[model samples]
Target: MMKVMVMVKATAGSEAGVMPTNELMEAMGSFNEELVKAGIMESGDGLKPSNEGYRVRFSGSKRSVIQGPFVETNELVAGYWVWNVSSMEEALEWVKKCPNPMFEDSDIEIRPFYSMEDFADVDTSGEFRAQEDALRHTLSLQKASLNNYLFFSGRCEEALNYYVQHVGAKIDLLMRFSDSPEPIPEDMLAAGFEDKVMHCEFTLGGAKVFASDGCNDGTTLSGFSLALTVATAQDAQRVFAALSENGQVTMPLAETFWSPLYGQVTDQFGMAWMVMLPAT
Candidate 1:
């Protein structure tokens, strides 16, 4: 895939700091959602008027700051998006579907970014390419997130409610098998499991957790533990005790080299967890 920078050129109105109307904002928001669903948009944002920005000029290391609203409004960029697209044509097609970005006449410019392969002839030693690859790897890591997804054999709702009562988890979304866009196979679910949670999302503290009543194949949660870090030993003790109710405690909460309090337990639904309070 190739990357492209889509620039929304500044218009006279944009340079004057005209804000988008609510209707226009909604339209753009919907358009952005489409781009995201298509997996083409990497990052995008609108910029404040150039008057609120500044430019630094260098003359043989002698630097001077130039304040804006600079001349040449047509040359200035009001906003931009970094998109990963199959080709320039695909980028153009997506851009065509965008809502009118400006209140008046405006232009959106699509420019392809130069890939590392494009510099093959110049970087004969491969050192610069390696550096670029490392930087990109770091960027990808920065953009990535990790979450725990649990499967409850037909008792997903029960498991979620247990978490709500014990862990103070808040359900964000819940979709039953019947509410699925495509019908789930009948043979996949055991009888009376049709109303079970097909998928659900919830928050424990600040972390998001996913759960589903997957296919009722009697699969059990094992091999991993959710690590819960709290600010105080009292909080850790409270959570550890809550998770231990009607469950097994593998290790009792106590002071260790790493934390003031720490313990491991398997909750009522068979999910394992580690609760700890780091020493201040």
Candidate 2:
């Protein structure tokens, strides 16, 4: 089964800065009712005007800031719907019938949500798998609430290595294909992918780090990130400099009371990296 979210984009010409006309509102309500009756729709909602939204920024050693009155009118998201569908084809079938929210000629973006199976080389044979299943079941029962942080794919090895080499990370467990309990399956060996790391871990200043090299579909990383917390400003600076090499910095390392130092970067493997150290 697949979960999808349909996003309707509002354009300036189609949106005259007022509420929808009565006729359009009625049509939309009818469409929504139909969706509710179909049992495929999980949730839907219209957004408040974009001008009412604000961006929050956390500044180190300073008060947070809020910036509002968005400037990008062309990319406003008017509304969205979450649906449980069998396939992309099924999702498209529903989206095709959605009533136009704007005056006319509006565009909608349909994207699928990733399941645990989407994780590369995910383990399904132990206590961890059971915990994951239980959590997912709970979330589904609650209609899929949003999680504060999203998980990323690939780049785990590179990030861990960087931490070990530069941030004083101790390798607690490093399991490569050669280190597996059983021989590499014949099919897997024949596929020329057996040399990849199966499961690996690094203990960075008492925090456990995990990674794997299987389960990728050859796509670059997007829409996920990780946060790391350390012990001191010097430790944060050391880890940040090491990971930032050959990578781009999203936020420069700076002093913060939340931690003595904090920063974020995307490593050479295109995975986001974060470092934080406690204030003295």
TM-scores of all models?
0.60, 0.43
Give the CA lDDT, 0 to 100, for residue 273 in model 2. 70
- Positional deviation of residue 176's Cα in model 2 after best superposition, in angstroms: 65
**Global Cα lDDT for candidate 2:** 0.67
Candidate 1 lDDT over 1-280, as tens digits, reads 9999999999999999889999999999999999899988889999988999999999997999999888899999999999999999999999999999999999999999998889989999998998986676555435434456677777788888999999999999998988876667658788887888876889999989867786664656523457666655556666678899999998899875546787879999998877776444
Clashing pairs in 1: none
What is each predicted model's overall lDDT from 0 to 1?
A: 0.83, 0.67
Give the number of the best model, judged by TM-score: 1
Q: After superposition, how far is residue 193 of candidate 1 from its true place, in Å?
A: 14
